[model samples]
Target: MNESESHGHIPAPLGSVEPHAPLLSVPSDGQLLYKISSVENLLRSIVGNYLHFNRVDSYADFPGADPHDGRQLPKDQQGNSLARFEKSPDFSAANYYDQSRARTYACCFSLENSDFIWKNYANGSEKGKVGVVFEFGRLRTMLNQTLQPGNAALKYNGNQCDQIFSVNYGIVEYVDWDTHQANVDHLQNPIRYTYLKDKERFSEEKELRISLSAMGIGQFALKDGSMMQFPSSLQLAFDFKAAIADGAIQQILYASDSDSDFLQAELHKLRIVSSKG
Candidate 1:
């Protein structure tokens, strides 16, 4: 089936807006998103027909990434207040803000197919790099269908815990945190932070983020001698072979002519074809 036939019908893209509008907005279904990575990673994803999300905290090595990317506490619990809580006798700040327990796994993509993205993400590797193009609507459809509702048992501080799984995708918002304030309620909805980035990254990366979040309902003690139920983290992967069959993937841009030949052969071996072809 064709693109429109696959997604039912395409919607108009959400145009540019002021900072901190709704955190999630859908682009035009026909819009192409690019994922640049090492050829090995691309090949693995293609051959396995799966997308893998690394724990959000493990992105410390990414350029211009915040050191505390996935570890931010709620607004009321930040800065000087956090210092005071750290010294509190009744409050165990570590347990209360146990980022490890509330895990977020993410895979990133770019709306722009620029040289900057190519150099930063796909360059400087002996193995070379490649960019995979995905159609927005089909990808969204695949992710929605692939989303599985399940429960997980977790252990934190020797206590048994349970978490529920959820998935989200959207355009990443670039913010000048020095000036722009995020209107999100981090205490109740921390997963929204996954779609935020510093303005320094705005020019280079127009990002689209897909995140899988697993949060538990365990209660933790606050510095005020009160308890609040918070989310614990989990990680997961999803198979997209069916979406591929429906033409979610648009094209593969290889680093070289030789790489193109290699990909054509590899894709042929996997029995994959672009909808355009």
Candidate 2:
């Protein structure tokens, strides 16, 4: 067939097809907003279609690990990575996201019954609020991340007893702070430190450290040397305060004594607990 006849149905290319590519390119400045909108629409549609979240009941196991290159850490004689710290399997997505970079990462499982929803609001001025719907993918990605040990974990001495110490530990969870009241009740008992098996667990000599993290916002290493991540549960005393701060979150304050600091007092308390531990 003649080129014109065979390709007749094909419209003539417009000045090198690449020239039209710009139309498909998303503007960097607007990309975030677009993503937010898309996520919101997807969430509404999913929620509207599904009467309940029963679809998310299944757990997706982690896929096989990729082969480690020469850059991978060396294993000890026992085949353990000396640098690796042992962790629990009900692995939290918050922990993983806390350690991982802000960039994209792999999910531990597919979100079958779960649906993710994100809400973005323009706060006064240039700042804005982002509300996120928790889902399996987000949860798993977060679990794979880690918290900066020095910041999130606090060790301090208590005023009541010289030997009394306090520790504040934080974990990630899909549930919000309000939902954690029940969980905290369960954790009131002494936590045995297997790592310090020789040390006895102390009950009276302590206060728990306060933990703070935004629900929708992912973790970030702050400029003042603090790391931020989602909290398993937030303290009740700071409920209103936390809601306000998280709503206006742009940058996380890492190490300031200002009332704006996320968990300064909590950290101090945690240290006290740790010393005892």
Candidate 3:
């Protein structure tokens, strides 16, 4: 057995940033109840609508997983040990998320406040703060197209009735199994991050408008000969939600240093605002 298998856990090697795990959940308010049928309708209403991803405040993204430790989990048919998130392949994938690529995409999510994601990604360690789950309709569209994939192509009706889908979350790590350290050393630091005169200063905003360029080529190579890719960046808007107790949200916006320079640091502090602001 491998050393990790012998010990029954994987340790986060030193110098690696925190692990990136998104929250998952379902609702429990007594005011509303969902039948399998009704949930389908509600989802259908927005089948073609767009959901947004936001830049996460990684340090603030806790009340979450233990970065240094690992858990004992089940294995897949191929002998790949399954993390809790990958156990329910269909159900979990539909509501998944990850923020590790924020260095380039300048976007990530948390379950700190999102109860819905917390319940679904319900391993004791997986806590999500991003209250809402943006369910992707599985309707792949090309750029500037008003069209959605035909219904036959979506995760709707028939056998796919209860199966919603999302690739927003990350579970598989980009590390070495033996060392459990980042497989690629340089990629750990976002290229744009170097431009900051003050790594701590962020910005202020309610809704965010991310352009296509803010996200770099969006793909990087790992030491293991595999490529790491972020979810394609979409033109999304973060309409201010009512403020919660977290002080003004000082987030990092990872766009190109400017519209003109995708190579420099566009990473900075962004103070998120509420409608009340």
lDDT for each residue of candidate 1 in 1-277, tens digit (9 for 90 to 100): 0122112222212211112225576578888999988776667776665676766766666565555455443442443123323233333333333442255667788998988777777555556788878898888776665453333333344564333335677787776645544433323245556666666755478888777654322334334445433332232344546656676877777766226566667767877654453
Which candidate leads in lDDT?
1
Instruction: Give per-residue CA lDDT, model 2, range 1-277, as digits (tens).
Output: 0122222232211111111122121122111111112222222333332111100111122132122110111211112212122343232322332222111111111111112211111112122222222322222222222222222222122111111112112111121222222222221111111001111221111111111212112223333444433222211111222222333111121111123222334434333111221
Q: Of the candidates shown, which would achieve the greatest TM-score relative to the real structure?
A: 1
- As a whole number from 0 to 100, the lDDT of residue 274 in candidate 3 is 27
How big is the RMSD of model 1? 12.1
Total colliding residue pairs, candidate 3: 29
Backbone Cα, N, C clashes tallied per candidate: 5, 29, 29
Tens digits of lDDT, candidate 3, 1-277: 1122212222212111111212212222111111111222212222323333323222233353222212111111112222123334332211111222242222233323323333432132211111222221111121112211222111211222211112222211222223332212222222212111111222111111111111221233343445433343332322222111221222212211112121111111123232321
lDDT of 3: 0.23
How many Å off is the CA of 171 in candidate 1? Answer: 1.3
Ranking by lDDT: 1, 3, 2
